[model samples]
Target chain A: MPRVDVELPSVLTGLLGVPRVVPVEASCLADALRELSELHPTIDVHLFDETGGFREHVLCFHNETNTRWLDGTDVALADGDRITIMQAVSGG
Target chain B: MGTTAVIGTAKGGFILRSDDRRTWSVEGPLFKGWKLTTTSRTPAGTYLAATASDVYGTAVHRSRDLAEWEQVETGPAWPAAAEGGGNGEARKLKQIWTFGHGGNRTYAGVDDAGLFASDDDGVSWTPVDGLNEHSTRSGWFPGAGGLCAHAVLVDPADPKRLWCGISAVGVFRSDDGGASWTPKNEGIPIVIEDKSCKDIGRCVHGMVADPKDANTIYRREHVGVFRTRDGGEHWERIEHGLPSWFGFPIVMDVPTNTLFLAPLESDEYRMPVDGRLSVYRSRDGGDSWEDASAGLPAEHAYVGVLRGAMAADQDGGVYLGTTGGQVYVSSDGADSWQTLPVTLPRVLSVEVYPS
Candidate 1:
């Protein structure tokens, strides 16, 4: 099993009750998110929309690569990979 | 009673505690960098703050003490974009404009124009479908402020009666506990040129209900100030004593029949009239107005006060937060003013809690 460090923005740490960075064991991006959601269930709605897709305003970067532009969340993860979730800067 | 002024701002929320109304201690930017658009207190003493981020959607946070906050997971949400609702535009909760408490329910007016209610002491919320799914919603377009349902007034006498004000769409009243709604903009002048002047296209800036009589209401609008004696069945222009017709935020002292408004130069230039900071007050129910600028800046103050950025405490203490990040307080019912010691981000809403 591969492990990755997940970084959450300040906007989410208050709701998720987790530190800015946390390490979780997973084989892929989807598995890591699932583990993150398990750790903090209330954060799912903020990350994904009703359709279970990444919310329009959310941006997930897998070490500076936009995850949405990738082929799929099933892209294999490796040990020490970093995943950062941020909201697209737009409105106030 | 100790007074606490809870202010919502572009960056977060601040709580100012005052024992003598002259000295104060401030705590906050709670919710730290998130935009706190509005703040209110439930009858049960729960403080609710409406928070939003361009990325995470809108949420409400509740606190018993002004320090610790717990975000409500079940905040307002619109139906799926594919649901064919919201007049073909995706309904998103951009801002939570106002909160009203009546009977055992708490109501929230939200941007993208919708109403929501919480029966569980601000812990959760449910959309008021009657207003969200109204038949005439298609005609309710966005104004300069965006299509925001910014005012909620729940009649104290009848828990079932309520009124909601939205930008450009005007006001709507519900007689059956929000099960249905009817437009209530009989005499409000419409300022948007794209919409029909004869219809419900009036852009209401801010509204406050008379504490003594829920039937009487005062509103500052894009065109002018207005009042309704019969709970929105009819409204009359009441901009006689003001320096300018355009303004935002209206606060009323029901005990004295006094109303306060901060008039802007014009809709195109939404700054204080003549670049001077002045708050106008009407003592006789909007018949005439008088400048209430004592202790405020005399000139070169070109800031604008937002719609939800002014509030009146139960004891008649008034406060106004301006876009330039100044908080002005008037302990003697708007007769004079004193600026708070600190400067903050753009103030969105000002609420007073007396304990």
Candidate 2:
């Protein structure tokens, strides 16, 4: 099993109850997100749209690369890999 | 009772507290970075704020102390695209414009032109299927502001009697609670010239029902101001002395038969008439209008007030926010005005709560 760290923004900290960084044991990015969602059910609505697709304003990065531009959420994760979730600061 | 003003803006919401009408202290930018469309305090003292993120959809937040807030899980949402009768229209909840309270029930008028109801204190919401799934939903075209159900009125005399105003779709009234509805634009002016959709194309910019008499309602439309003596069954033009016929906001002092409107130049130039900022006040139930600009700017003031940006307190205080990021208050029934010290993001709504 690979242990990956997830970083959440300040806006979600109160709802999710997790610090800026939390480690979860998962073998792939998709599984790690699932684990995160299970721990924080309220956050799932903000992260995904009605069609189960990633929200347009949400950006997920697998280490330094944007996960959206990558192949898919099925990319394998490795020990010590970091995942960051952020909201795009575009609209009012 | 202490007074608190809730100002919703493009970036977030602000709460201004005042013990005396002379001075005030501001506290916010709450829900930072989100567009707050409206805020209302239920009779039970619970405050609900309608907020939206361009990406995360619309949400309803509730609070009791005005400090700690919790987002409601079951907010207004459109039917999934796949189940939307194959019209292929992308149904999204763009904004929540107004909130109406009746007994223990709460109603919300939202963009995409639909109504929603909540029973458990704003914690959850269910679409009013009668309005959302109306047979004429397909013919309800979007106006300049998009298809937005911006005003919802629940008759205090009869909770079963409800009225909702949607831009370019006219007004709809339901005598059987939320189970059924009928279009109520018999005397409203149709701005769109299409003969086929003449009856349903009246653009209602803002509407308010008399607090003392639910049967008497007034509305500011795309062409002019109108008043309905028989609920919304019949409307008559009331823009007799107004500087301009086009405007967005209408606030009323129900007990005094006083009304306030911020009229723009016209549909083409949606700014103050003649670049002069003035609020037209009708003290005789729209029978006559007067420029209530005693203290407001008189020169080169080009600002636009949105539909929900003006509000009136029970104590005769009138407040309005402009697109230019300015908020003005008039303590003497709109006869005089004073600008607030702070300037914020484009203001969307103004609400007053008396403690």
Candidate 3:
């Protein structure tokens, strides 16, 4: 079982009203999100597009660097790997 | 984990959320009718809320527990009508866009005029008479938004020296604590083609002063994002790694000086590259930038982040509310992000309470 650690965004933590960090089994980064989507259904709606591609403002990182700059969406994951999902927000 | 507060405004009033980086319980729709513009906590356990409504003039509300709210009407109130009370007509009362607290006084940037100051915790007010006395107000004009003061930076180390960014006016600095003001636009680029950009302040969308080093400041102008090392004396544009040079809302990690910006796609009015959402970050100030839009939607889409919709936490966490009624969160700095459940009619502002 590939161990995956989920880190909830600060904005989500406040909305859900709790700290969320769960371990799941997945072979790739996309699989991990699919598994967690079962727990937070709303997130999945904004994460994936009509063609099932990631949104433009939405960014994914395996560790600290962007996954797009690495292996695109085919990036594989190993046990104890971490993933983060964030979107762009701007205001003056 | 420390306490962080998130205040957002909508159709009815304001909502307050207190969290400890992990959990948060809703505290309010604190005030009614007024869309809360800004909230800043005072050292004496007091909180100030700047609000504006369609029916009433803009006013500052005060609170103690973040629950109960009271409108402060004694001090320099908004201009009254012929019979007294706020302008009885439509959209007449001024709007308070942003505010800052320094020493024992809290200053507010009221739309249509200059700044307002309060000494007794939002109880009373007096216009910073110097703004009228200043020789620069006449030269300062309104931008995309009507005449509005959207950003105010107060040097924590030196209360007397301060800077404010207005919509169309660019940036102004007052080193003698509002006694006088000057236009500081030396290296800032201007939109005009004939005159010198030095005399006029560049059109600024958002700005943040490093809490750790007051001398360092980052700003997002109508053209690009620029930083000043020796305060506003000089500036350098830094938009090499961003998707588009046009953007609003710039936030900094209070203790770390890390900067975050949300850029909109260029070549279009208010559209993203591909229906995507991307938030960029600069860890070492604005020296460099890295995109943190993983798990976000695609580009070439129509979604614009408005002013006052982005905020950050002391834990390196960032939050943003969009015009599409969506809120996104990033816990591990700006490395990765995810969507949140809270949706609003139209998110005017998003803030994270410090822990």
TM-score, B chain, candidate 2? 0.96
Q: How many residue pairs clash in all the candidates, one count each?
A: 0, 0, 44
User: Global lDDT of each model?
Assistant: 0.84, 0.84, 0.68
Report the C-alpha lDDT of model 1 over B1-355, residue by residue, as the tens digit.
Answer: 6899988898888889998788889998787777888888898888898887767767788989877778777888776672323257666667788889999899999888888999999998999999988877767778777899999998888989999998888899999999999989888766553333355777888889986788899987887888999989999998887889788888887677788888889988899887898889898888899999898888999988988888888677889999989999999987789999979999988988888
Candidate 3 Cα misplacement greater than 4 A, ranges:
A1-92, B2-4, B12-24, B75-93, B192-198, B266-268, B299-301
lDDT (C-alpha) at residue A43 in model 1? 78
Arranged by TM-score with the best first, the candidates are: 1, 2, 3
All candidates' chain B TM-scores are 0.96, 0.96, 0.88
* Predicted candidate 3 versus true structure: per-residue lDDT over B1-355, tens digit per residue: 5545455565433343445444545445555434667777765668777765443335566778666666564433333221111122211225777778788778887676467788877788887766533455545555666666788888898888888887666778889998888776667777532233345645788888887777788998887889898879888988778878787899988776678888886524765655677888887777788888875665544777877889887677888777776777777787777666565555677766654
Question: Candidate 1, after superposition: displacement of residue B42 in Å?
Answer: 1.0
TM-score, A chain, model 2: 0.90
Task: Please list the residue runs of candidate 1 whose C-alpha ends up more than 4 Å from where it truly belongs after superposition.
Answer: A14-16, A49-52, A88-92, B82-87, B192-198
Residue B48 in model 3: shift from native, Å?
1.3
User: Deviation in angstroms for B342 in model 3?
Assistant: 1.7
lDDT of 3 by residue, A2-54 (tens): 88887765544433333567577888877788888776554443355433556
Candidate order by lDDT, decreasing, is: 1, 2, 3
Binned by DockQ into CAPRI classes (incorrect, acceptable, medium, high), candidate 2 is acceptable
DockQ (C-alpha) of model 2?
Answer: 0.44
